[model samples]
Target: MTQAFEGIRIVDFSQVLAGPFASGQLAMLGADVIKVEQPGVGDQMRTTMANNKLADLKLSPGFMGVNANKRAITVDLKHPDAKEIIHRLLADADVLLENFKAGVIKRLGYDYDAVRAVKPDIIYCSVSGYGQQGPMAGKAAYDGAIQAVSGMMGITGTPESGPMRAGYMPADISTGITAAFAISSALFRRTHTGEGQHLDVSMLDSAMTIMSPNLNKYLATREEPALVGNTSPTFQGTANTWPTKDGHMQVSVITDRMTATLVQALGKPEWADDPRFTTSQGRVEHADEVKALIGDVLAAETTAHWIERLGNEGIPTAPVNSLKQLMEFPQLEHRGILATVPAPPGVEGELTMTGAGFHASNGEPKVTSAGPRLGQHTEEVLAELGYDAAAIQAFRDNDVI
Candidate 1:
């Protein structure tokens, strides 16, 4: 069946996490995404060694994660004739995406205005550290920097840890997902207005947007929440992790009724009537006592025992799973979050990649192919753009592509 974005074409001039991630989403939805990278070197993420998985995949885990289901080609954007190649690609594309340090795309002469001059209704998106203009516009940024600046790090981890970053880079991942949503919205808007616009996606802005709920609470109460580890500030001990006989298990009691269920599950039926942990507010106020009481009881059993026993009582509980353990989870198979694609050059068997999470009513998301090697599609793409042997050789001689 034809997918949601079957006929849409995207000229992806982005790299690393945020930009490639956005275009990769388009590719999954059946858009034709052509990834443009610097000649020879390619994306720096291509070298990211994600636990020796690169050997079997021929690309780094980071690159493979975000770059599947798209075509890749390299062009020397610094070369004078490079502008000709970029505009030629944009001439028929529906969207153009780039993430450069501030003022760089414009300096390269393919900013929104220049690209729009080629395709009148193309959606142009720019991702950067900050918005187009601000005090920190020129500052170099990555996941950790934005996490620190946006107060995400401050609110995460434990008091003893003192402002630790999240286990994974939420800033980059969230920004990429948000940019895809924005581009999708813009595509929908074009149906009505017959117009296209430029999108300025700032990683800092994306970080702050995700922190809105906590920020709003702080603003209303004028009180900063404590950084209690493994527990949400809103509920404290109610949604926290506890040590078990073997490993650890996470539990959450959202309502007063659920607290009673947890109490019974812990074999402390009398504590269900105790005022110290009766309500959500009370649990937050006496979090230390509540955590200690539950921790003591939970330490008596293995994670499997608690998960089954608590789950039977309708209490939310789960064992803390390592990456390797998660890979063996049965739920993932049912959900189809993992898929296999043909391996890229040099890699042996079929390569697995994470699929787009949601299912469309008409068709499910797909990963058509594995990640591309540096400029693997360069010759084929250039030939399709009407570059014959002589002109192609001339570009090669001049290092234009």
Candidate 2:
């Protein structure tokens, strides 16, 4: 079976998580993504997690996690001759992706105008901290900084501890998803119009977009949303994590039937008719009392017992799992959500990583190649652009590859 994006070609100049992640998704969808890196040093992520104590330097787990199904080529864009090589690759590329700071590409003389001059149908995407323009346009920002700036930190933690950043790089991941959508949309438009466009994706813009609903609610109601720990505000009284004899379990008693079942399951049917907890609204008004009552009942059972009992009753519930437990989850395995792919050449088998997240009904997504090592395909990619062996050797001799 043919892949979804088999004929698409992407020239990727993205480095870290966000840009690379977007391009990686495209690669998973069958785009031939050629990741261009600086000579020798390569993507900063290659060495970011390389510690003396770790076994493999090139196979850093962090590096392997984000990059897959792409080829790598090294070119010193700063070198005048190398610019021609990049132009050669862009001449046939359907998309160009980069995450450099504002004006860096323009300085390198491969800005959208220059690239479009070579391939007018190229979908050029630029990812950055801020956007291409604004007061903070040139300022550098990362996931943590964007999280703080976008007010995501303010709503994360518990009320007692005050605001806190999320445990993961939500800003980066969210921005990457936005970039992927924008690139796909641009590709679709190109199919019809045969015109390419410049797409700008900013960490700040993506973070703010994710936070808009909460910010809008606060602005409209003049009511600040409090940090409610694990439970959502709308479902405060009915939703909570309770401790069992063995472990913890989260339970959601969203409907009357579920609430009734939970009350019966806990052997506290008397509480069902109590005026203070009869309705969801009434329970919210007396959330503290309801929580204390439920907590007392749950403290008597083990997590496994509660899961078996509550699940049988049709109440939505689950045990909080650690990363290791989640990875080994049976459901994920059954769904084929996790599978290992071979490591790139020169990398060890111990360096293998998980495949893409999406699944296709028509055909399995191919993992044809692993993330490229620094400058691994420099000569090969240039050769594809019609350069002979002598020209590539000369460029390498000049420290331009």
Candidate 3:
């Protein structure tokens, strides 16, 4: 496989979304990622599949969504001998990832200080709800809770809906992606400096970065923007999602040219001539009026009709697609961003997971497998560690594996 991380090894003690996603991205790039879950129960994400049918196989779609190309092993971290297993893995691992609550990994004796002792050049990353030394560091936080703390929920929904959580865990997912990016960059830095360091990634900090545009606006104005659903929060009403006769479409009126074109496309060229619509800022000030005029005419036609006409006129507009529609998007199919992998045992057909969000000239990414089953690689990995059958059986009998 022509993957970037082919020679790297990652031992991840992270659970749930953020940590798994980060390791999964590295795995997609062909890292030998060992995902260590608790014995017997495994990572909680294996059961977070919700109503999906693959829970019996211990590979939920939600789990498979990020765990492709990973080797999972179950080790009870609370056990005294767990440190030996972790040290053995870290002796060869280039990176270590964990997302347990603050101080948990350190208490378990696998923290950055301990890990670097085993491998001085190891990149150790700890993802937490807050940072390692914040007032909220000790508090338990999940995605939804972090979203609220990070001001995402406050600005996510419409004013009418009050504060609403995102449908998916953006905090967890984006944090994971950020962690992977940082991990790769850290490795690059090590190549030059011959040093490795601890990385502290906070979900709250990540959320703020995701809200940077809005946060910038707030800092400048000294006031948080009110929740305006389906509207551009930075530019206010200039960009909006309008209901077409058959469906909804988002139209961006960021520049004067685009606004004029939109007005002309609506057969209201005279509207752009008005002083209220003369400048882009003026148009933004009168955004409601602009949207009403455009949305009225747009509401008379189907989304496809508006998209075709607006696209030809150089107006930025597109049909608001649902999740399934996005999955079936022709552009995505052509781009080959997703790959279908072997179905986990007992499941039918195949499972599709996304790649590393780019194309490689050598070949496609090495995302070749689905999420690992519970303890699926435990015996195999132990054997590779020079544990004979008797020792393996003893570990199993002692409930250590």
Candidate 4:
């Protein structure tokens, strides 16, 4: 079966995380994505987290993680001849993705209006720190900056440890996923209206959306959220992370039924109906006592023991796995969230990266090609665009491509 974006063509003029990640998702769904990068530098992520070996190869593992299934080409957007090449590429393009700060694209002469002039129905999606129009529109932002500004940091961590950002790039990845959805929606709308529109996605906005529950709670109650940190929202001490003999286990035994099952698992079924620990209100009032009791019992057993016993007893429980432990998890293997593709040229062995988060009936997400080498398909793509060999040579001589 054909993939969802089988015949769509995307001109991806983005770098780092958000823009490339959004285009990468569509590329996985069979869109033909042409990654436009600076001639020598390429994407900054090509060296992010790279050692000497991968850096010299210009194929950082981090870069490949988000950039699967796309072709690479080099272009100097400031060059005079660059506009001609871009116009040629956009003549038949279905989407144009960029992540430049606000007004940067206009300075480069490829703003939505200029691009729409070439492809009337092109989906022009721009990912930025704030948005296309705002007081901070032109501000440069990184994942950590966005996480702090979007109040994500404020809501994370414990009271003692204070506000802290997540270990990973939550803002970058969230914005990428959000931008992909917006672009997909724009494409769908174009099918009906036969018109194109500009999409302005903000990393700050996306981060706030990811923290919607906390934001909504604060808005409705006029109270800031407390940094509970590994504690369930129920505020029940039984529904928090507890240290076991071997590792940590997170349990969410909030409801009366689940609490009863948990008490049985701990060999204290009598506590399930005890007046001081029976109701949700009572548990909250005696949270410290409940936490001490549960912690003492859990400390005597291994995390594996609790996982098996509580899981079988229908109490929501899981081990707080490390990244290494998580990779060995059997459930992930069954779910197939990770995808393995052949390594890019000059690299040995296969490369495994994340695939689509969900599955589909027929046209499931796929990675047909590994991420490309820098400007790996420049000549091939230009030739496909009907540029003759000498004309392509002239472009190279003039530093245009």
Best by TM-score: 4
- Evaluate residue 167 in candidate 4 and report its C-alpha lDDT on the 0 to 100 scale: 93
TM-score of 3: 0.95
lDDT of 3 by residue, 349-392 (tens): 88887767877787456678888888889988888888899988
lDDT of 2 by residue, 210-319 (tens): 88888888889989888877765565576887787877889877666677788888888897898656777777788778888888888898887888888888889998
Error of model 2, residue 371, in angstroms: 1.7
**Selected candidate, larger TM-score, 1 vs 3:** 1
Deviation (Å) of 76 in candidate 1? 0.4
Q: Note the clash tally of each candidate.
A: 0, 0, 0, 0
**What ordering of candidates by lDDT runs from best to worst?**
4, 1, 3, 2
Candidate 4 on 1-401: residue-level lDDT in tens? 88999999999999999988899899989999999999998999999899999898889988887889999999999998899999999998999999998999999999999999888888999999999886998999999999999999888889999998899999999999999999999999999999999999999999989888878988999987778787776678788998999999998877777777778889997897886577888777787789889999999989999899889888889999998999988899799888888999989989888888888898899876678999999999999999999999999998998
Stretches of candidate 3 off by over 4 Å are 234-238
lDDT of each: 0.87, 0.82, 0.85, 0.90
User: lDDT: which candidate is best?
Assistant: 4
**RMSD, one per candidate, in order:** 1.6, 2.0, 1.6, 1.2
Question: Whole-model lDDT, candidate 1?
Answer: 0.87
Q: What stretches of model 4 exceed 4 Å from their correct place?
A: none
Candidate 2 Cα misplacement greater than 4 A, ranges = 50-56, 350-352
